[model samples]
Target: MRMLHHGQASAQVDLAWFFRVAPAKRGAPVLVVCGSLLVSHTAKPPARKETKLTAGHRVAPRKVAGDLLVSGKAYANPAEYGHSRAVRVAVELGKWRKELAVFGDRVWLPGLTGSSPSEPLPFTTIPITYDRAFGGERFAWNPEGMGTGPGERGVRLPNIEYVERRITSPSSMPGPAGFGPIDPQWRPRADMRGSYDAKWLAQNWPGMPDDMDPGYWNEAPRDQQFLDGFRGDEAITIRNMHAVHKNFEMRLPGLTCRAFVKKTDGQLIELSMMLDTVAVDMEAEHTELVWRGATAAATPKLRDMEFLFTMLEPAGALTPPTGCYAIFEALRRKTYPTPEEYADDTKQAAKVRAAKAAEQQAATDKVVAEALTYRDTQMAQARARLSSYKHPSVPANAETGRHFSGIAGTIGPGIPEFGADIQAEMAQNWKMFAELFPSDDENCTWTRERVMKTHADGGDMSGANLSGLDLSALDLTGAKLAGANLSGVNFTDTWLQKAALSKANLSDTICKNTLFSSAVMEHAIFKKAVLTGAHFNRTQISGADFSELDLTGLNFEQCAGAQVNFSSAMLKHANFRNCVLPNADFYKAKVAGILFDDAVLNKASFNDAIGPGASFIRASAENLRARGADFRNAKFTEITALRCNVSQSQFDGADFSRAILTRANFSECKLKRSNFDRASLESADLSEAVLLEATATNVKFLRASFEWADLTGTDMSGSNLHEAGFFRTALKETKFVGCILTGTTLAL
Candidate 1:
């Protein structure tokens, strides 16, 4: 009585009513119901068989499996009894569970699934908490069994035990009747449970191919319309529900669909996706894809519903539902971030920009310093050259004429504003030269007293017309008469020392016994002027024109007269000792007895000048042109005439002892009794020249030419005649002892 009768049924139920309804057959309802029942239990129904259930009520096979998994009951199936529901639910669960067990204890491989070898373990563990599964039930916590011992690396793990315990519902309520017994030892084992290892999942899940369409999910027309019309404030968030198992998320906020997949080892692996405005969740293996502008009201359909959703593999395996492939594609190109790591990256970029800015500033500062130094150095050099001018003393035997009687310590007018007065005076002077000033008679009524008054009042009187003026015996020392018209003027015994007469017109002027020492007479015109016994010592007469002038006995010693013109001038007995006359023109001038000792006449033109007994002792005359000049008995002792042209000159009894006359031309010249002892005459030309009784001891005649030349009674001892040419020349009584005649071309 206590145990046998299971008990009278508490409620009488219609078994067929709980089952799926079947469509009525054409003949009767009995056969239709029988056929529907058979179709439900069988694996395949006949292809031509008519089912009582219409398409609307029918469920797909995989969909039934999913529903069973979610609800733990196959309500959509034809099975009505409790035993059938339980058996169907258990079977579907076991099937899925068995597929996921392959990755239970497997480790992940690197590069194959975007998992790096440096990443920690894929499986994680947590303490089995009662709140998660057992609702405040006391339980033993074996920390060593839960991976808390020395065998485990400290990492956050998924609550695997709690999930399994909750999902399995292993124990039923304990009652008097032993319907189901509670067993603590009957726990889920690794062989029977599903595994969701994060690394394993990430390694097995499929990703977008390199050639797939990137805009499949994001750029469709319907998706664009939905996105464009959306205006929501609540941020849309997504999460990978089974990312630890399949490397995939089930629900993505902005995308239409997502999926999870089982690996060969039965582990769920996560896969990548692409979507617009997607932000990655970098906290763990399983995380959500967050975005903006998504609505939760209606289910989002795929942008392109016509194309079947599929996950494609390299081997062409198609996993269905590929609508949200853009999201995974975009994620593949992205780098995940946590808030703290992002902040660190931003700080690092700021530091790098600051460093570059500092470097550029340092470079700019260096350039500015260098520029300032260069400017300061150049200013110092200019100041030195400007202050080199020395003021001359007034001589006693001179005129007492006064015009600001003290010597000027500096050059030029002091007040720059007074330059206008000088310009106006020049204008009047020019008008006077054009026969327009002072009633067109070319007359200047300015007096020395008036000029002195003007000078005292700081008025400039430069470039004034003082021509034909009787300025003799006047003490005009250190006066600023620069650019003045002093043509035909008389300056006998004038104390005009240290005067600035630069660019002045002194043509036909009488300057006998005048003291012009330490003066700046640059570019002064002395054409046809008489300068007999005039003193020009230590003067700056550069670019002066002394052409056709009577400059006899004119002493220009120690003067700087570069680029001066002495062409066609009468310079007999002129002493230019220690003069610097670079680029000076002495063409066709009568310069007999002119002394140029220690002078620098570089690049000077002395072409066709008549100068007998001209002394160039210890002088530098590089690149000088003295063509057709008559320089008989010229003293060239220790002179340097490099590349000089003294062709067609009379050099009888002239001495070139210890001279450096390399590349000099003595062509068609008379060189009788000339001494060339210790001279360097490399590449010299002596063609059609006379060299009777000449001494050439220790001379270097390398590449020298003596074609058609007379060399009677010449002593050529200790000479180097390498590459010398002597075609058809007279060499009577000529000595060639100790001479190096290599490559010499002499007439046989």
Candidate 2:
């Protein structure tokens, strides 16, 4: 009432002329728009609902856990990010996650997701920080979490997380939204959003079975992707102008019409598409689906209009590369700026050189310090083991705890490039590694003399901690390198004959055609390391560790080791068939057909070991003490053992003909297809053992004990028996074909 009618009408009079135009109905004029509309609408994306006309791909779903462990879990579609999230997630979810009963099956859970309680049990606050919704830095990136640490208990975890659940879908089919953009439910908040599929959305929002539910939001996978962008405590949000529906077109980079789409219907839709943004199936390392949702409101025209870009998730922040080597490379390029104080003409080149020298010295000192600290830690552990020396007949020599040297194979011609005239890049890398682990440089150096001498002659240094170093083609024949850190080093064409490298850290190292024959390398760590074409033949390396190392095409024929550790090491094409490896450990080692026939592996262990850890057996170990091992297809001929111990071993397809077992113990072992013809068993203990297809002829039996043993398909032909007792031994299909009977006794 206070305002005049004419003035009130002026306020309402036209600014509405700028209104956005809509498609004309019955050839009518479009509506006018006004206000804060940033961008104009684009064209409506075409729909290609080829769900019924698509094909399927055979894929396995894998559960990831531990360090780089992939569960062979296939998927209907493949996704990949090189070795970034895929590898990391694969390792964590499969091996370290949980037991079969813990998960509902098939929903590939990440490390940060709620874990099942089976093997790697899941908890509420697992201390992990994935999925971007971290409660903060509660969980650190620890490969050996809890008991998996180096100093922790030796509890070997099963790497493959066998996910039992299958991909399940809802009973009813989900229909598309009529003519509008995706509802708020389909495109929910970043932290509280479900998948693009309506079925998954239903799981998040219960009320909207058919209609769009505003409550729909992210669960685990989406939340993780969202957080990967924002990072830390920064708040981020993605806005879209229109609702999501089938009527809009999405435009994504790095994709084309030939690109196949993985639909929720478990098929690969061959129909071409145009999408804005896409959901990345990180595991398969591919863009699985093409999103479509952004219609063009045509005001009776369809020319060059505006584009309404729809962001899929919160904006992400780039994380810096944390790899030490990457940082070192950057610094090597002089990318690290110098100090501001050194900007004067008086302090020009000369001062720069001085500063560089100082920095180099500091780096060297730091590396030395770190090595010393590691040494101190090792000494502490050795001290703990030293207490056993008090026991008589067990001095527990420090050298015994470590393998120092072995009979190296003959040195071949010196490598061509090993001589001083190598590439500058190679030289710098070598120097860098030597600096990181200066202990390897006990007397080695890359100074004027060393470098110049290398140029004149051949460069060689084995049994050294060239970790984080670049040492390509260094002549290290007959070098002594026990317990060295060689991680991330290069040893292309390195000569390491008979080099003692026991208990050494060789993780992520490259050693192509490196000579390791007759080298004593007990208890060596080779995790993610490559030793292709390495020679370990006839090497006496007792108590060595070869875990997680690639030994593909390596020749270990006739290699000998006592109490060796080959857990998680790849032995593909390795010729260890007839090697002497008594008292060895093959816990989870990978092996292939190469050899192991008629060698010695007595008292060996293969406990908790599996394939990729497999091997062709062909060997025998006499007078050894091995517990828990697999020797499938091993051979034994004329093997005599006195006071031998073979417990908890697998000897499938082993032939033990003409062997002696005097005071020997074969307890808790598996022997299948073993031929023990003409073998002597005097005071032998076959307690709690499993033997199959063994031929025993002319065997001496003097106080032999077969207690609690399983003997299936044994042929005892022409065997001399005296004081042989079969107590608590199960004999199935046993044959004494033409065997002598003296003082052989059996008890039920």
Candidate 3:
């Protein structure tokens, strides 16, 4: 049957086999199916019949439907409108009824979405179906009144919508009365999900005709002949339907094809499509051989494959063609070779499976043996005390531990205790383990070549000793190095982010500029290691040791390092912003220009540290210590340093505004030029402190001590000194305006 766009004219339909019909001369026309449309092309034929589909034959009786008329005009007959051709077209309509036209001499087949043809005048007019509903007027066959009105002149075609930031409705097709502004910016509703798959088309193409009936095409029955191998739900996705170059792709059992239409001519002119299949040749080992019962025969060998080849074709105007059937039939006549030919029996298959399992187990055992050998060699070298053997840089005094508190922290208390001689031997083994791995090589592991080869062969070395390796600039991000011995390893500029280093030994390891962001390093040792410019953002460093390290310019943002040790360390310009470092140890640390902003440092220690230019803004340091330390020019704004022991410290040029230092000790501190405005120093001890040129305005000094303190040129105005003792104090030139001096002793 012939298809109709607006029930106007008719063209010949031919179901010619692509490989047999297209002319071999120069460049012949061919139809190729690409995704959704049928595209046409003109390409030169091969010199020889290279395709196995050369034996394919054309379908019989290619004439689908005949005899039709449109708008009372007669279409071209087969004798004049070239030769008849067959076209298989599948249309995708979401929801719409098929538009029907008049039927007379030659019946018009139901179209994808639009109108059918009328009467006996050599039928014409092909239909193009889209997967959507574009509301407009339908093309009617007006045989009685031709060229009467504008509607009778021609049929209108729909246009695609442009999804832009803003959309303005056309003034011609104005919205209903009482509607909002006509040029209002278009916005997709939440329920609509997006504009592409909206039920109603809101924006129409300007200057484009809308002739499609939104409610039609849904009731139309599809012809099975045109949809032979189609999955019955063939439609381009909403995202790709409006693309500039549209293609419909599909794969059948033994064939593949693409359907598309040419748009260079600016019109939906023709359906172009292509199809492809394969061919093979085979023979049995014996002509009279029983193919099914030869498995028990002695020395039975599988049949050999003779030849295998591919066959490509251009299925021009072939709607549900018969050439595909012939190709598959030829393939069926031959037997394809497979791996089953070798095994043939269930027992053989089981043997193959067991062999593979055994091979895998053997490989795993080999790797384990190699790793043991490497570890033993390292231990033996350390015991020999050979001059040629190199050792890792561990803490000088292992008993005191370089960073953490005691000996147990250095070599891990988890290590079993031994006698004196055995302990010495173990210590040497751990210290010298770093010599086995190379620093500059990519394979920086114990027994470098062996470990490297093992890893390449997909072997596991989770607990491998990689100590003292020069692992600079190594890309080990997200590597599973948990529980690995990484002591004295040089990780300068290495990518260790998101690596599993939990409980890993990183003692005395140099980590300059190393990236450990988001690493799982809980309880990992970093004692006495220099960690300058290291990135530990969002790392899990809780229970880890960082004591006695020079950690300049280190970034620890969002790290959860509770109870972590930073004792006696040099932390110049280090950042601990938004960290959860409660009970962290910073005793005797050199914290110049260090930042602790928005950090949770509750119960942490900073006793006897020198922290110049250090910031504790918005930090929670309740019950923390800073005794005998120098905090010159430090920022403690909005900090909670309550009940802290900051005795004998120098707070010169410090800013403690909006800080809570209740019950804190600042005894004998030099507080020159310090700003304590709006600070709460209730029940605090400031005995014998030098407050020269200090700005303590609005300070709450209730029950505070100022005995023998120097307050010369200090600003204590608008302060509440209730129950405060200032006996034997040097208060010359000190401002006491608006001071509450109830129960205050000012004897000096």
* Most accurate candidate by lDDT: 1
Strongest candidate by TM-score: 1
Per-model CA lDDT versus the true structure: 0.55, 0.43, 0.54
- Select the stronger candidate by lDDT from 1 and 3: 1
lDDT of 1 at 436: 42
The sequence of per-residue lDDT tens digits that candidate 3 reaches over residues 107-207 is: 22345664443323322322221211112223121112111124522222112111221112211221111001111111111121223221212222111
> What total of clashing residue pairs does each candidate reach?
30, 110, 46
Point out the higher-scoring one by TM-score: 1 or 3.
1
Poorly placed runs, candidate 1 (over 4 Å) = 1-444, 454-459, 745-748
Ranking by lDDT: 1, 3, 2
- Give the least accurate 10-residue stretch of model 2, judged by summed lDDT: 57-66
* TM-score per candidate: 0.40, 0.34, 0.39
Q: What TM-score, to 2 decimals, does candidate 2 have?
A: 0.34
lDDT, candidate 2, 1-748, per-residue tens: 0000000111111101012333222222232221110111233222222221111100101001101111112111122212211111121111123222111112222245542223333321111111111111221222222212232121222222223431122111112101011222222322233243545232322122333232232212221222211111221121111123212222222212111222223232222112222222222222222222112222222222321111122124221323322333333234323365335434687888999999999999999999999999999999999976666444466647455443222445456556655776788999998787748655564343453354346444344445676666766665555666778877768776777677777788887777777777777766777777767787776766676677767777777767677766766657775777776766666654445556677666555554322333323455555455565665445665556665667766666566666677766667766666666667776666677666555676567666546767776666654556554356778766655545544321
